[model samples]
Target: MPTITISLVLTFATPPSVGAGGASGTLADKVVARNAHGEFIIPASQVKGKLRHACEQMLRGRVPLCNPPRAEQMCPQIDKDDAGNALPQKDGLPCCVLCQIFGSAGYPSRLRFHDLVVTDADLLPPETLRAMVSLNRRRRVAEAQRLFLIETAPYFNGLQFQNSEAITGQVDQPSHIHIVLAGLQLLFAWGGGTSHGLGWGDVKWEAWLDGQLINKIDSEEVKQICLS
Candidate 1:
């Protein structure tokens, strides 16, 4: 199993909402995911979903990736009649590139994401994890029934992929490595509220096999692959 260690500096363009999986808090209505250390973190599942979507968009030639990569997954291209009545997709099959990596309904995902922990070496106070309040627009005021709180992470963090089989077929390892690297740099977003403007980050990738830094991914390499 080959492993890729990735480093990222995340600057939230807007408030992010990576759901905490429950509404157990006494004060805030919702919370962001955190570790036992009380540090804000993004779970591996979130990372996988974002990357899978990016792969589907770039490889499948769709603007936004499909939900389940199925027939119901909204296609960007629209069909219409002479009268301008929209038509549904006639084919009921999913044949996207994500099926090869993340797997389809019955297949298993080839990549594994390790939880990305925020490396806030500044040792800032735990209270820095800001809690924001939201109110309803219809009421013209903040009401208890419509009020909610969202927690946001700090500025910078580190991310990693513990293990992934970049190449499953019988070919040179370098070819398979490039395929996975391109997916990493496909300009993806993480956590929730991305559509609402949040979690904007870029990755500087480094790979290791048997404890050796073999290669670094550059823009030129990615361009060459896209051209090919």
Candidate 2:
């Protein structure tokens, strides 16, 4: 089994709105995900979602479950129609690579991520209050008067996990873990406002096997396997 430790220096490029579902305070619209510890944290679920999407992009049609004959119905690539019914794939299968590793409807993901916790609370960026408005299509001007505050960590350090269970699964496969780490670099944003370009981070990955460090992301082997 390999224990993967990722050190991330996340520099928020834009305001992120992970959304606590509702808003409060004088500004009253700001929402973000926070931990019971009262610190902003990125959940493991979020990381998993990002990794899955990144894998899809990097692997393209290579994932068995994502490819035709198997993905037609089960793949996330398939979208719902106007009536809200899901369209079928031309050829679908029981599972894709994502399903195999991360699990799907019937399976459980082999990969696990520990929630990313902020290292220094004081280092977190101060919350920013901004005026919210919608664009008017007719006049192309800002409309509607809404105020919200967004708590964002413009710069901070955090820790996350990528554990590879040795006995229960096949971590011995070279392509399996290598491909996964590569997918991390492909992740662009976390939380919300991603479409508007926010939450980008520089992540450095390291791997340990049996209590001994085995790989650093910058290593030549990793460069060839992951970066290339």
Please list the C-alpha lDDT of all candidates, in the order they appear.
0.48, 0.51
In candidate 2, where is summed lDDT lowest over 10 consecutive residues? 159-168
**Candidate 1 local lDDT, 145-166, one digit each (tens):** 5444445554434322222332
How far residue 77's Cα lies from its native spot in candidate 1, in Å, is: 23
For model 1, the local distance difference test gives: 0.48
Local accuracy of candidate 2 as per-residue lDDT tens digits, 94-203: 44455555555544555566656555566556765444455677988866663334454334334221223311233423445556667777876777555545455555
Top-lDDT candidate index? 2
* TM-score, predicted candidate 2 vs. hidden true structure: 0.64
Task: Flag clash pairs in model 2.
Answer: 65-96, 69-91, 69-92, 70-92, 70-93, 72-89, 102-109
List where candidate 1 sits over 4 angstroms from the true fold: 1-16, 26-29, 62-96, 128-147, 154-176, 195-197, 209-228
